[model samples]
Target: MDWGLVGILLLMGAGGGFAAGLLGIGGGMVLVPFITMIFTAKGFPPQVVVHMAIATSLATIMFTSLSSVRAHHKHGAVQWRIVALLAPGIVVGSWIGPWIGKQMNTSALSLLFAAFVTFSALQMILNKKPAPGRELPGTPGMFAAGGVIGVVAGLVGAGGGFISVPFMTWCNVRIHQAVATSAALGFPIALSGTLSNIYFGWSEPGLPQYSLGFIYTPALAVIVAASVTMAPLGARTAHKMDVVSLKRAFAVVLFGLAAYMFYHAFA
Candidate 1:
């Protein structure tokens, strides 16, 4: 549609994708809140824009996660066994979480999202010197963790890396591998969340033009293009730099964003 809008979308995707790889975040943590602001500025109905932004963000994350996961897999950083064990729970939880989220007020959702962002930032800052080795959670336990992560993912339109990495680390998986596995898990979270967004928005009318259910096509196009291309670069950067330093920097950024979001929601 509009070339200018397309450009913005691409930049958003690239930036979000790069951050996802570099910071071990799902990218949604950055993308959703920002996209919501964009939609708000465009004069979309405030009540609906937040949901649309989050849903579109999840859709874009689906692609970014693939790129990030592949890069991690190549480096032997992904834990396939864990991904397999957790996917079922993630899929089911992701599907249900959005349904519940759709019923909540816009301000409440934004506040919840802000809290999650702050928590993620704190976790990154605190998780310096990870624990020892990998511990395989049996089927039941893995599913439990996945379900929790999935529900959150659905509500926030996130990759769940914010929660997944720590959970994996707590289970004794190495930090790098935990981030990688979390990246892979994002794919399922995005897929289920996207579907749920569509379901939730299917009957509603009078949305902004160029939207497909809850996803705004223009934004999705931009985000997917930029993020997919640059995510690998972030993965590469992770290899070159000191992880603790990067994590600290990432935490600062998250804190700033969280503060901005809190203001946006309340003010």
Candidate 2:
């Protein structure tokens, strides 16, 4: 592997992982576009470049989520009950997402991803709270919500935190608990999504070397190494910082990324 490529991957991973821990995100919002650009520069076929970037981002999330969850768990912030309720539907929905994504046009998928990112960023900027008396739904409702979160996350290669955290908070869960629980949910989302991507793309042609299905293994390896190490530090930072301000700052960054992605889709 080119050392320069490795360096870039490591940098992306570190940034993504830190965001994951700090914002209760899986970091795919950051990873997907950057990785797509890197793969494009490497001359990968445009049709498959986004797919590969999403797949690799999901794969990396498996590790980053684990690391972030561990940190959250240490603080007794994770709500395991919610995770248990969400896992079944999340797995099924995640499995189906890649199959659907594989049939979409590359530019369409990129635009969709950009839109999702922009929406999530706006949510952070607004920081809206739900009704004071709201509460979590029963098992069936939680499962359905998980399904929606999983499908969207799988398509975007995210950890589902953007959706999950908000959903939990709307149900009157505390912000820290919602964030922690969302970190735990990332495990199932990433795992199921990665597996589906691997299966769906197993027969695709023109994938780059060192790839396993849609996942680019070299980038995955380098990114995972840096991300896992940095996740705990981010979690620690999250505990100490003013998350609301941090989120607004992150929203500005997301807006920039969204603009870039929009240009890429149309230009």
Candidate 3:
């Protein structure tokens, strides 16, 4: 890999990993938009740039998730029972989501991606703390929630934390537990989506040289290496900081990026 490219990847990873830890937002919310800009600058076809970015983000998330989950698990923050309950549905649904996304036109896919990010941001802004006495959703309900989050993960090549964390919190899991369990789920989301994107995009004509299906390997390598170290750092900071303002700041950033993508997709 080019040293310059590796440097870029490391920077991306650091930013993504830190945000993942701090906000409990899927790193994809940050990763996808920035990666798309890189793809565009690299002379990648506009139609496929978002797909490539999403695919690459999923690949990077595989590593970032592992690091973040390790940190969270070390603190005994993860709810393993919930992970077991949700894994089956998440695995199946995540695998299918990206395959379907890959089949759509790139413009449609980008718009859909932007819409999803916008909705997630809105949800973050609007959702309030659940009542103290809230109860865990039953096993069946957890499975259904997992399926929904899986589809979102697949469609956008995200870690699914935005959906999963909120769902867990709504089900009466504490905030930290929700964040940890969601981190655990990130591996499955990234693994399933990356594999599906590979299958769906394989043999497609005129794809950039050295790309693995939808994923660009050098980009993935850069993003993963940097994000691993930084994500844990971000999580540590999140624990020490007041996060409401941070969430809003991230939301503004996401909205601005989404708008730029919308212009690129349409103009």
* Prediction 2 global C-alpha lDDT: 0.90
lDDT of 2 by residue, 175-262 (tens): 8888889889999999999999999998999998888989999899999999999988888888887889888998999998888789
In order of lDDT, best first, we have 2, 1, 3
- How displaced is residue 25 in candidate 3, in Å? 2.4
Task: Kindly list the per-residue Cα lDDT of model 3 for residues 112-228, writing each as its tens digit.
Answer: 888988887776666566554666677788778788888889888788887787777767788888888888888888888889889887877778988999899978876777888
TM-score order, best first, reads 2, 1, 3
lDDT of 3 at 67: 82
lDDT of 1 by residue, 50-151 (tens): 788889988987898888878888889988988999999999999988888889877888888889889888877886544645576789988988999999
| TM-scores, each model vs. reference | 0.93, 0.98, 0.93
- Model 1 residue 27 lDDT? 87
lDDT of each: 0.83, 0.90, 0.81
Give candidates' CA RMSD values in order. Answer: 1.8, 1.0, 1.9
lDDT top scorer: 2
Question: Which pairs clash in model 1?
Answer: 9-222, 9-223, 10-222, 13-223, 13-227, 14-226, 14-227, 133-172
